[model samples]
Target: MLSKRRLTGTISNYRFYAQSLATASNSLLGELNDWETDGDLTTKIGKSLAAIITSLDALQHFKAEMKRSPLMPKRRNADAA
Candidate 1:
């Protein structure tokens, strides 16, 4: 079974990756908008990219909320009682 600390670390890694992917996708979508003509294919690709970015953003927000909630274990310092 996975320990709480390991599970927290895994979620943190996932959140980091999701943020990275969302940022990259947003940048790419911006470049595509600036360079590509408004054709059916470009439009479809843009829509897909938008959907991906939205999903990633949502995942990050969910992770943040989970971290703030009481269910996640709080970090402790060695000096604390």
Candidate 2:
């Protein structure tokens, strides 16, 4: 029993979270790259890489859900905005 507005709000929040996750993953990957270059791949760096992989999986799932949801359009172009 969710109102349309609330549901849309939920989706918007999820999208925002997904974007944040992507940003975080990118940042982590950058750190990982730096670690690799320095040859200091410690346990913490490995853990961060693992976390990035997990987040990427979750991002794919959320992206698929967003595509399937009625609230999302099939295609969105930046120039269209």
Candidate 3:
């Protein structure tokens, strides 16, 4: 069985990865918006954007679930420090 500290570290890494992916997706969408395209290409871009948005939504849900998991460490309040 994994130690609590190790397990927490792994979960933290996963959360970081998810955040990185979301940031990258947002950057890609911004770049895509700056591009000028024809009707066919526009349709393809729309589909791609939809897929990216769906993936981001799923990641957000997963993060929320992780926050609710008992194994995850509780966050400290900065003001209480």
Please tell me which predicted candidate would have the highest TM-score against the true structure. 3
**21-54, model 2: which lDDT tens digit per residue?**
6776676677777874765557656766676666
lDDT of 1 by residue, 1-81 (tens): 345686677677767767767776776676577665545656666765776777677676666767766666888987986
- TM-score of each model, in listed order: 0.46, 0.47, 0.50
Task: Itemize residue pairs with steric clashes in candidate 3.
Answer: none
Specify the highest-lDDT model's number.
1
Give candidate 1 regions above 4 Å deviation.
Answer: 1-39, 78-81
Each prediction's Cα lDDT score? Answer: 0.68, 0.66, 0.66
Candidate 2 runs further than 4 Å off: 1-41, 75-81
Weakest ten-residue segment in model 3 by summed lDDT: 37-46
lDDT of 3 at 74: 91
- Cα deviation in Å at residue 80, candidate 2? 20
lDDT of 1 at 30: 69
Q: Please, what are the lDDT tens digits per residue for candidate 3 over residues 1-81?
A: 345686577567666666766766676676577677544656556666665666667667667766776776799999999
Off by over 4 Å in 3: 1-39, 78-81
